[model samples]
Target chain A: MRFRTRRGIEVVAVADLSLDVADREFISIVGPSGCGKSTLLRVVAGLVRPTTGDVRLDGRRVEGPGADRGMVFQSYTLFPWLTVQGNVEFGLRIKGMAATERTRLAQDYIEMIGLRDFANHYPKELSGGMMQRVAIARALANDPEVLLMDEPFGALDAQTRIIMQELLVNLWQRTPKTIVFVTHDIDEALFLSDRVYIMTARPGQIKQVLNVALPRPRSLEVTTSPVFVDLKRTVLSSIREESLKAISLTGTE
Target chain B: MAESNTLRPIYRLGDDLRPHEPIPRSHYLIIAAASTLSLLALWAGLSYTGIVQPTYFLPTPGQVLATASRMLLDGTLAVNAWASIFVIVTGWAVATVMAVPLGILMGSFKFFEALFEPVVNFVRYLPVSAMIPLLILYIGLGVEEKVAVIFIGTFFQLILLVADVAAHVPKDLLDSAYTLGASRRRVVTRVLIPATLPGVMDNLRITIGWAWTYLIVAELVAADKGLGIMILESQRGLRTDRIFVGLVTIGLLGFCSDYIFKMVHRVALPWSPRIR
Candidate 1:
């Protein structure tokens, strides 16, 4: 996919990128900054149409953003004018669900995210971690078949990120949906994903795909396991070399 | 932990600091009361000391208060106050009706923005006061003329401001809404409108002040009733006390309307940030 910026300069973002995510699979894409990881996610979410090639969901060509897919951005994208309940109800309300049903559904997701007490609280009243949880609940309440998260916990503190990661894993288990998570954090990608697709820097294409054979119901302690460490070591060294090449080519380091 | 918190480099100077956390409502009330009393005291002192020389130029606070009461008793105050309120509210409401949709269009679509932006910018720069003669020629000396004055004064500036506010509705939120199955119209009515509401309310609050600022110009052209007319009549009669009464009444009315707008903002948009 290529994009022309406001300055009218054409830049190739993604090239020769194709991957089929199995039903109910959890996939993560990790790459250096400006590696078009987000661009790839946007294509799936149908927020950005690729310059060439088509994105198909359920054997149908993806035309635009639809309810079949939900997205959680890196930044806190909860509508500031909406309370927790209001935000969670947004998609359901748009879908013309009855108010009582919408409220019940929204409340279910809010409780899932552990923010039942703050159902009436506005986004401004929430901490960053809490707000991201609202964003997640909002996306999930739609009952979308696929959830596209663009570094959802990247804005969080380290401690909060870990807690959020665990909470996400738990939520994923309970709600079995295809999730395509994009992040730059190798550890986060390793911890949460069944398959981690690492991309080359700029004009991004999948360089490697690491299958994490880590056991289910994994905890933070699994991060210290030798198998996890070995995988991390291999991924890191490969990515480090790609990252160095990226910096040297761009001369932006 | 306490020592570390205290010793940490404090970056509390900027407006982003949530320094005044959860102060009681009554604390604000006390501060407001004290501030008003000090200003009143200052006004009284200025007049009593004869520093504001000649009673004709500046009436004493007591004189103004007495005149205000007398006007109230004679029913002139009520009549004129209602007249002023009617025109301001009518003009402001009309401006809001016209500006909001136009602003949204201008903000959302580049084509519309390019078409209207230059014209609006140019017209806004032309003084509303300067356009009074032309407005009178077109709309005449009735309340319509005055309403036109206030409308012209606020509408242009408001459209521009509302457009800016609408444009600032975060892109991510819009994208998120679209991904959530909202149609284009749904995006506008559900996402865009509600998201920009608090900011638009803020814009309305400020432009309402501008509406009041244009009231004197509106009434000065030709009007038998209203605070501006009251002030003009007083000035002609050399009744500085009554003029002071008119001025104070306008100030008091402006303050009350501001309070009303704020109350509306709070009640209508409870999800917005609390003032405290």
Candidate 2:
């Protein structure tokens, strides 16, 4: 979709992009910088309405943000004012669940994220990985049908990012909630996703959909596997080609 | 990012940069006491040496203390302090009651913001001291007039402060709130209000200090029975010690209220940076 800059220049963020996300499937969208992976996730999350086309969830047109889809942004977006428990319980609280019930539910997710000790701690008090874990728990506490994460580990240091990816994979294994994970890291996409969608830069479109045939219960070890390495090479080359095309089109590099 | 991986020990010792690990409370108390005592010592030294004609310009600390005791014993200090506190609290409360909602509305809705931003901006720049004569003309130099003056001094500035704070509520936070199935009202209440509250408390604390600034201004053309009036009366009699008492009284009161505000902020916003 085209967006006008403050200077009124038309920038097409995404165009001619169409894909069906399967129920209970873990899908990752990987692309170069400025690709519309995040925008696509936002569309499904019903945050920004598409200018022309419609996003359908369960055969119903996505109208606006709803309880069924939850999103975690790249930044540590946990409300800095709230304790970890408070942040986790935010969605359940908004859903009008009774205090005791929401508290009980939020505690479970907090425990799942292995932050039960820090449940009463504020977001500012936690490290980036810990904060992102809370963000994940917060999203899942509402029991949404789909979790839309936009490079949620992008801000974390490399070690933290790997740990977060493993944690996410473990969580998905246990709950198997439908997840639309968007990232620029091809290794991350290969390590965690059931299927990886590679998109072109700028007016982003899905260039390829590579189904990761790696075994279940994937770990950090998967990234070093020959199969994972081959998939990564293919994904990396496609992304590099598209990035070069984008640079040529924009004529600024 | 990789630099953090060096085996350098990560010190968890509380410092200014890390709000999560605040410096201990006793240390803060020590610092505060030391600063207060040092200032008092400086004043006492200057007066004892007759640096600026102690009897006329700067009263000796002992003489000021004697005057304070006299006022306290005669109950004049209590009456005037209470009156000033009453006006300040009432005027500040009134300003908060009105400014918070209006500011939130202006911050939340573009239409209200567009409608009120220019007007509020225009009025906020107009000094409250400049409006004293006009306020007296309109309200006639009564207690109501003083309260009105304090309110006017605080309200417009608070509105703008609150609006700016509310406007800056993180966009990611608001979007997350929306995706959580929060209605517009809940987004304002649950997210925006809570997120902006620490800043609001800080702003209110500052504005209350500003109210004290306009206290003397408010009393300049007004009736009696306030600390400002007490200072004015003392000035007429050339009672430098009494003037010092009044000044000290206002300062002490402001310090007490600031401490209370800090306490309230601590209780209300546990996530915020604490006293160090």
lDDT of 1 by residue, B142-184 (tens): 9999999889998999999999999998888889999899988
TM-score evaluated only on chain B, model 1: 0.86
In the order shown, what is each candidate's alpha-carbon RMSD? Answer: 4.3, 5.4
True contacts kept of each: 0.80, 0.78
Error of model 2, residue B46, in angstroms = 3.6
> What lDDT score goes with residue B130 in model 1?
91
Model 1, position B28, has a per-residue lDDT of 62
Worst 10 residues of 1 chain A by lDDT: A74-83
Show where candidate 2 strays beyond 4 Å: A80-82, A97-104, A248-253, B1-42, B51-55, B271-276
Off by over 4 Å in 1: A80-83, A97-104, B1-38, B274-276
Instruction: For candidate 1, give the lDDT of residue A45.
Output: 90
